[model samples]
Target: MSVDKTFYVTTPIYYVNDKPHIGHAYTTLACDVLARFKRLDGYDVKFLTGTDEHGQKVEKSAEGFGTSPQELADRNSANFRELAARLDCSNDDFIRTTEPRHIRSVQALWARLVAAGDIYVGHYEGWYSVRDEAFYGEDELVPGPNGTKHAPSGAPVEWVKEPSYFFRLSAWQDRLLAWYEANPDCIGPQSRRNEVISFVKGGLQDLSVSRTSFKWGIPVPGDDAHVMYVWLDALTNYITAIGYPDITGEFARYWPADLHMVGKDIVRFHAVYWPAFLMAAGLEPPRRVFAHGWWTNEGQKISKSVGNVIDPVALIERYGLDQVRYFLLREVPFGNDGDFSHRAMVQRMNSELANDYGNLAQRVLSMIGKNCAGQVPQHGEPGADDREMLDAAHGLLPKVRDAIDRQLFHEALEAMWGVIRAANGYVDRQAPWALKKTDPARMGTVLWVLAETVRNLALLTQAFMPAASGRLLDQLGIGPDARTLHHCGSHHALKPGTPLPAPAGVFPRFVEEEGAA
Candidate 1:
């Protein structure tokens, strides 16, 4: 696709019941990388990420903290903003459910669905989970180790009976299945798609769209007794962000989102409920929904009670922000659960970033400083090795692009690094230092190949490791405009004889323990 095409993507708005953790950072970083990549490829991209402020959990947590819900939302929402900034997330908009725009949009959506007769006043008697802000059926309940039963949906269950509002979700099963069949890619990561499909196939009961007990959520239109269901309220943030009620010219431009990147736990909401809501409102579903996996602490599930959750800020401070981003995307396949260990993270930094990309950049820049008088070398002529290495680097652009488009982040990074590895091996075997003493022209050719490879590497890495890649490009004397994905395969990126800057270590080797290598 052309870079000029519009690509609207989002990370699920996170709940502010707790502070940001590594899992939240992982999803945001993934979206940021994709956003940066699309932008570098020259696309008009809208990347949305934000905090979901109104929910029962947030209310209870705020009460426990001895603060009002709004106060807690303000404090914790700032923490999320700081976390995003610390990780260099490039989200264009941050919507809060408490915002007026969102309130208006949710009301607008509710009115539309009600007008369409998809919503009805009803009595709800079910197992409600205040922790999850969801209601579960008997089949979805699991016996807890304790006396209390838990919702298999990852929420604590409570028996409740109240007069509330419900959406006719059960009536749309056939319609949802037809939509899925027509738009096969609507739900992503084939496994997640199959899971959602099976869940809907087994059956979808009517969804309770209001809670009488929670006052921290959006109030239902013309009904003071109930608040909008948290998911319904939360999902409206997407359209709310684009001026849903107003539908101004700018809002209409990006109405149907190109992609919604969410955690696996919320797949049903984004894929099932959100689409059903949109269909009822006479709007198109989001183009795609990608449900990625969770991150555990060294193979143990992360839990607040366990007190082992990885903090993104601490990780960024201990390592660097780019290091954190690289580790999250590179260490785990995007859609599969992976263990987070300090040892594994350090190893990846030392081996991949420090040893491979960092070493290659340091060597090439140092060689240019010493042999070529701190200037990019003039290419005398292309040899077999040079041609072969250039071809390899060129071949990677398409593969990496395709992988990224498929949302295979790890595969994309690996494909890009293959060229980095090849170029490093070529440098080691060619030994530009020795060639400089024996044959100056051959040395220039070898240095040219290495510099060219570095140029391409800088472009490819810019999306994932912007800070480090910017440093590498600065040392190579490549301009900001030259550091784009489109310029990766081209050999004319570096101007011959451009005065290169001094070499500095971009990624220092990560050391662990007292004396271990």
Candidate 2:
């Protein structure tokens, strides 16, 4: 693919102070789905994810663990990297903020901002949340117990006063609002965009860009005592991963990333500060920043103290991998809060996957195996029902493409399942088994039509459930080269008389043990 066909997407580099959780998996899975969809559509896609290692949180956590910060970062970063593989995320690059290349890239960005007169030495006094690595103004804090104050996120704050470098965020207020107005789609979900606009319009302040009290972050260029603030250093990872400061290689090809997928809590950093930082440095901001909502487990907010943080690995171990992936993206609308329950997961698994889609593939293939001599049944055409079903299956590409472009994963899956439900009804209405006796040739055409529909369904579904879709396509005798989005219409229908593999269930029904929770 050429540069014009490139699509770059990213997940926030996760913090190393916390273990991998469902939130991390959720954000990355959404990006993976988008990247996969773009690739199938013939775009040269770059999917980037990694760990954010520099921050006072990680430094303090390192002290508590009785290890050096680097050692702590190393061990925890490896766990996150392993999680990506376990979740089957198809990321193109895994970057660590601690890498030497990143350090150089960050320093170069600092130089650019300094040359632009955006950074200057100043005294900073404010409430800082080490946990969130953010500065909170007086109005944003909530009253806590014992006359203390806490950040809106509920993380405790501490008063800090020191000499630091400041970014002229206040100076960019009008420009930022103008950019938001000019490029309305730059920030996603409409709700998030409104929140960011309100925050900026209320007032912008010169943001502190360096910390003198903590030595765990990237040091400001030419200043040894002060280190760059965590958000400044962390947000640069997006550009650094693609070789920033050179803008001649991958950076030139994929800069101005197509999308940056993040959780809702950090919208201020991506939508506000990160873009300002880039524009100051003579670089283009990413095309879009999508902030998805949080997930609660069984009605309670997921917290370590609650002892209910959903581990992605454990979820996959209990239910199948694709089962977990499908339920996550299918269970709730993107950009909205969702609850995770065992009941809901199992229901989707059994009814949607097993009964609706899985059973459709099984019955049709089983008939071919037994009645059609175990090969793709030859079809004699011109039936209205067949045309309607085929057209629906073939038409799914555009509907899904539109939904996914807007980051509507659940809607895309629902559109695909709509056809699945119709295919099930088609089978019932056609009654291929009844035709087996009266008109054997008519039964063959119905079965062939169903098979062609399944082939298209599998092709479109490969983005959401890669492993399961690949297995389904394999059962249909689809070659690896013939599985892209272009291969989904009638032009690429399954060939007659091609030998299919023995039929087996792709999505198994989830059964709960009697004594389990």
Candidate 3:
């Protein structure tokens, strides 16, 4: 990919009905890593994440807590903001559905679709799920183990008949299938794409875009009897954050997002409904929708009733911020479900961060400070071992880049760590401390190789662990700007004779104690 490409990525604006959880953090962290990577690679990147403030869930949750919807939104949205900060997320915009800009954009979209004769007033009679805020067709219903039928998507359903406005989604089925066929990468993860294609092929139903029973959402334009469906109100957040409608110039530049990172359960709305709405309004669909998997707590599904919903703030407080971020991205593949456990988090921190990356940095900086008069040594000539290590570091750049581009975050981190491991092994084999007396020139070459390897590792790890990598770069006397992903393959990031700073522990190990209490 071109380094100058513009990349627009979004995490689904989380609903504000509840406090932020591990699942929400996982999606945002994935987006953050991708955004940070793109920016480092010289892409003009826009990363959007925020809370969805208008929905029945939010209104009811507020009433249950004896607060107004706005107050509830403010509280939960603030919670999400704090959680994002704790995770070191670099989001460019935080959109709220209640913002005037969002209301205007959603209304404008509604008018455009109405003008195209794709929207009309009608009565919607179906099973509506208050928990999910979605209407389910009968075919999607399954008998639960509780002897009650529920939506297969894990939401309860209630039969409702009400006057509402509907979008002519059935009319776009053939067109959507053709678009999917033409653009195989539009929906992401071959399985998700196939599921969407099959659903479209089976047939499409007209989607109810307005709910008459809800008054807390955005009002339907010129229609007092109904409010916009939560999904319609929610998905418009993408354009609203970019100054849509009134600021056509700005909106036109980034209106069609490069990627929408969403949960797998809602992939239908993003890949199917959102695209159909865009096509009806004579706008292009988003470039891609990547649906990631969910996280269960300790191998069991998280449930509030069971008292096991993982609070994000609590996790960040227990584990350090970036430690939590690294664990989530590194623990599971982006598209597969993962089980979160305290034990697993402790293991990753001690084994990977502390033992692997942090220890290597401490060892190299200590050697340079002690042997080379606290100055970076020049890479004079490489023997067989030095050449092999250099070759290994050089080989990792492409693999890491490819993994990031493909959205395999864990794999990308793994590929980078492979170099860290190899470089550490090279140091052990060369025994630079012993060579200092017997072979000074050979020792210089080995230390040079070690310093160069550390420099490259710092560059690669910066995306995943920015704070720790920044410390690593500072110790090597390399400026922040020189640590960009583009500089990964450069042979000499640290100039000879550059004064080095004393290194500190980046990732201190977490130890579990015996029964002391």
Candidate 4:
């Protein structure tokens, strides 16, 4: 809660076997919004995202593409970088496993785990899902097509037997359980925590950490015959970005990251394996791991075969970027699955944004422009309705902050919209145009109250909707330094008689083609 503390948050490094999709954009956008909120909240924030380019799956994909693994990684990783830019992501660093710095850190972490006696040579014979890049016990497999076994996740598995180095995951099960007990908040969204707890309760087996079957990974230290498991190399990217192992600068400032935002499919890696690995290496685990669910398109699972895989770039092209950004977090509660539909998107755009928030800015700022000689108006004597709306606006910061802190993005947006709704109602009741003739002072007060409220709303919502909010702030005569929470909350006055630009609607109604939904 203190501004002096650092907030380090990360999205899971996306696997670079293919191009970016709605799922990847969704997670990175969430992290971006949180990072922006923290910076506006006065925290020193370090946000990270990147591609996980090392793995057997990537190698196979490269072969299919008629390219070497590094060539494939180079091409696909650039796509992710381009996607981040297109999405307006504010990630502080973008790391790839192929980077020398990352390779060094991964190897350092491996040596640390090895030195701690938590890793040993072993033979692994199990059901391996190349798609999932995970090994499963026979009992955990379900029937698949062609009489083959699949992971519970339905990813087809192949029986794999190989020489591998194993991490003593079973040895740390009790320690992990005890750690979870001591720090119950470490894994979030009670349902996710319960799922993790239940999984650990079923017991853990020693995990194979090095793969000899594939050479498209970080080579194990002192062993050229094997490569470190992809997850180990990938997860260590967090520390690598922060200058870990050496432990200076960013590492010293933001080690033991405040949050690891991952998808539900990979929760076990962060909640179980990651923490155990950290503790075994004599390091502290991350402060929290919050796993969010997947997204669906039009009530069906999103897949390439379905011809409905939502391309983030195409979605942004179809809808405005901030509009897409706003709907993603606002339509769904942060830790739950959500569906994307054109109908839903249009509704959110036209109603919540265009009508509720954008309309308020347009109507009140327009009134100020016409009535107050095109400048911010001064307040009149305090009145009940004015104070009520002012109270609602003033109360917004803490409420939004509380929701954002809990990662309840829907709650935050809803709370901001509550104040916005009240401001709109105040406009209807006072009818500022009528006041121009008789109660001019009261009208000025109303317009002033509305402008200040709109200013706060713009600044507050900027994290969620940057481009649109920037336009809103520009119309209100606000600039960069004036947009922080401290500035918004200080009861500051916009410069009276400061000439303002004509306001324009930021969110326009989305019109869908026939049968689009």
Candidate 5:
């Protein structure tokens, strides 16, 4: 496909100390959907995801396992890479912070910050959370059980004293506020933007940019003893993956990423610290950062201690791959917390996918096979119902594009499903099967409209469920080369008498085992 525009989207590089869970999959899948949509719409898209391997937590976890940090990172980073493939993510690149390219990029960024006078050596004494890899002020700590103090994220904090390098975060406070006010849509979901603004407004403190105590991070540019702080190193992965420091080639094309998809917990880092670092280095900040919420398993918080962490692989095994993919984005609003229940998953599959969309395709195509000699039926003439249904199918592109531009995945899916639901209603009212017996010519016209509608639905769904939608389009005689957003609507309607494959169910009804969780 020829492309004139470019889009770059990224998932927060998953921390290698942690296992790949549904949360990781959720973020990456959202990026994948957007990337695929843009590519189909004729944009040159770059979708990136990978692992963050350096930090005190990884060091501690490596010691606990009696292994070197690099060994642990290699093993775990491989798992995240596999998860992307397992989920069929169309990410163009997978980056690891430990890679030589990333090291060079991070060091280059550090040097640029130093040259800009944004970095200064200083003494640091404060509360630190190894779990969160962050420094929290005394005012931000909350009392936990047993009189222990924790960061706002509930990670335990401890007093630490060391010589460190600090980023001039306070110096950029006014500039950050001005930028936020000028670009209101840069930080997504409105609520997240407001929260970030409040934090910056309350106060700004110079951030400790290097940790003398941790040996598992990128060392500061001119000092070898103090390693760069994890967040600064981690956020650099965005520009690094796109080829920064060189300032040309991929960097020139795709820098200032179109979107950064991260969890709500790290909104402060991406929305605040990341941009400050880039702008300090005389670079453009990313276009947007969307912080999505977490997920609970069956009404309980997903915790490893509770043994309730949802595994993306297990989900795909239990349900089909496309079914699992569809449910994750559809189950909740993109920026709100959602619960995962077996009953709800089954309901969506059996009702929406199987009954509403699957049945619509199966019955229409099956009738054509039985009555129209297994070929695309030609439309007879214009009719009110036919015109209305076709118009709705054609109208979906703009609604979906608008929602997706705002990172509204659930809203975009709803817009496509609106057309699907309407097509089902049209099928019932037209009753092509009865027309096959009463009026053959009218039956052909109704079947033609339904087939065209299915073609549009399949094209829209390709971004969400590629394999299943590809199969559906195959049944409609829509070849792989013909499957793009440009091919949707009445303008690209199915050719008459085109040979079509036999209809088969794409989304099967998911059945639960009696003893299943």
Candidate 6:
């Protein structure tokens, strides 16, 4: 199908209280891959990711670090930016809530809601969980082991009485339910959508939108003593980065994002609260909210308190960046929780990258270099096996497009690898090395088909393993403009007689230091 619509996607603005770990990296990487795929598919894409710099947790972290809130935000937010670079994320904008643009946007949204009578002053007397930065209703609290009541998320809550500005979340229930019913696919993966539906059906209390006790957040418009709730402040980063409240620019082009990729833990904020807030401000809600599951370490849940958070930087250092990216996306289904294990990572990298993909590319390119004078060779009359192999490679583009459209990343990779695996089998059965001595013309034809397949595979691999894909494309002598989805389905993709660069491996096998090669 032809796609002409603009594609805008956002990762949840990570909290600035801590540095990035595997969880943060996973969400960012998913967004990056989708953005890359959309761009390659001829869509105008804007990718946004950054830090949620204002919250009570950040304030407490600042105090614990013996620094001011702004100072802590600056330091930690910079770390997030660095992580994006390390992961090779191609985000168009990195928004921080403390920026002047964001503050203006947040305050402007507050004024709009206030003008619409969605905001009202009220007394908030309930159980609050600082860790979750949320209020739990009396019935939602679970009994803790120490005779204390905890939030449903297992975070301890304290009863606090304070004056705050309330958002008319309760008033939007019928409207939200109607909106959701009208748009059945608004929330992704079906399971997440059902969770949101159940929560809204259960009923919503008017949420506290302004917290008087938190002095580190954006101040409510016309009420300087009260700061807007951190979620109200943070979720605005999506539009704030896109130039909201000013209208008719980036905001007009990308305001209603095509997707909001978030973790499952924050489904309510994105699926329920964010849409209601947008509707209240006379804005369109995003097209979809996809909340993906989390990860564990070696079958054990990873937690900061347990000291089991896997550092992504360390993983990248041990395994190549593209290898790590490939393993993460290929190892698990996109919307399901995955486990991270060193053994799994090593086995996947060594077997898939080194054995299947890398070996095929190396074997074909080396043979071409030796027999065809290091140039893309010409094809002869197609034999039956050659036709089937080329057809498989030529047919991959649509399958990849379909898989990526649904965020089925693993399926996309699997489709590409299927072509590679077939090419491997064809190479062995045809015995191109034997054909070189017996019939040179047949050898050229076989090598030509394999080269074209590798070129298309490398092009498709860009969305997931850009660095390694670039190396493969360079070795194939493919040009920059020709390496997009527009040319992925062509049978005559590789230009015959084009000089190819010397063969070098793209994906290196992982080995332990004790068994150094």
Clashing pairs in 6: none
lDDT, candidate 6, residue 30? 92
Across residues 321-421, which tens digit of lDDT does each residue of candidate 3 receive? 87888899999988888999999999999988899888888888888888888899766768788888888886777888898877889899888788889
Model 3 spans with C-alpha error above 4 angstroms: 1-4, 145-147, 513-517
Cα TM-score of candidate 1: 0.97
What is each predicted model's overall lDDT from 0 to 1?
Answer: 0.88, 0.94, 0.86, 0.90, 0.93, 0.90
- Tell me the spans in candidate 2 whose CA falls farther than 4 Å from its real position: none
Error of 1 at 446 (Å): 1.1
Count of backbone clashes for each model? Answer: 1, 0, 0, 0, 0, 0
lDDT of 5 by residue, 1-517 (tens): 6644999999999999889999999999999999999999989999999999999999999999999999999999999999999999998999999999999999999999999999999899999999999999999999999999999988899999999999999999999999998888999888999999999999899999999887999988779999999999999999999888889999998888999999999999999999999999999988899999999998999888999999999999999889989999999999999999989999999999999989989888899999999999977886999999989988889899899899899999999888889998998898887887899999999999999989999999999999999999999999888999998777789998999988888877777889877
Candidate 1: residue 466 Cα off by (Å): 0.7
Badly placed stretches (over 4 Å) of model 5 are: 1-3
Candidate 3's C-alpha lDDT? 0.86
Write model 6 residue lDDT over 294-359, tens digit each, in one string.
999999998888999999999998898999899999999999999999999999999999999999
Q: Identify the superior model by lDDT, candidate 2 or candidate 6.
A: 2
172-252: candidate 4 lDDT, tens digit per residue:
989999999999889988899999999999989999888988899999999999999888888899999999789888888
TM-score of every model versus the real structure? 0.97, 0.99, 0.96, 0.97, 0.99, 0.97
| lDDT ranking, best first | 2, 5, 6, 4, 1, 3
Q: Which is the better candidate, 5 or 6, if ranked by TM-score?
A: 5
Could you give candidate 2's per-residue lDDT for residues 396-511 as a string of tens digits? 99999999999999999999999999999999999999999999999989999999999999999999999999999999999999999999898998888999999999988888
| Residue pairs of candidate 3 with colliding backbone atoms | none
**Poorest stretch of ten by lDDT in candidate 5:** 1-10
- Higher-lDDT candidate of 4 and 5: 5
The regions of model 6 sitting more than 4 angstroms off are 1-4, 515-517
**Any runs in candidate 4 off by more than 4 Å, and if so which?**
1-3, 513-517
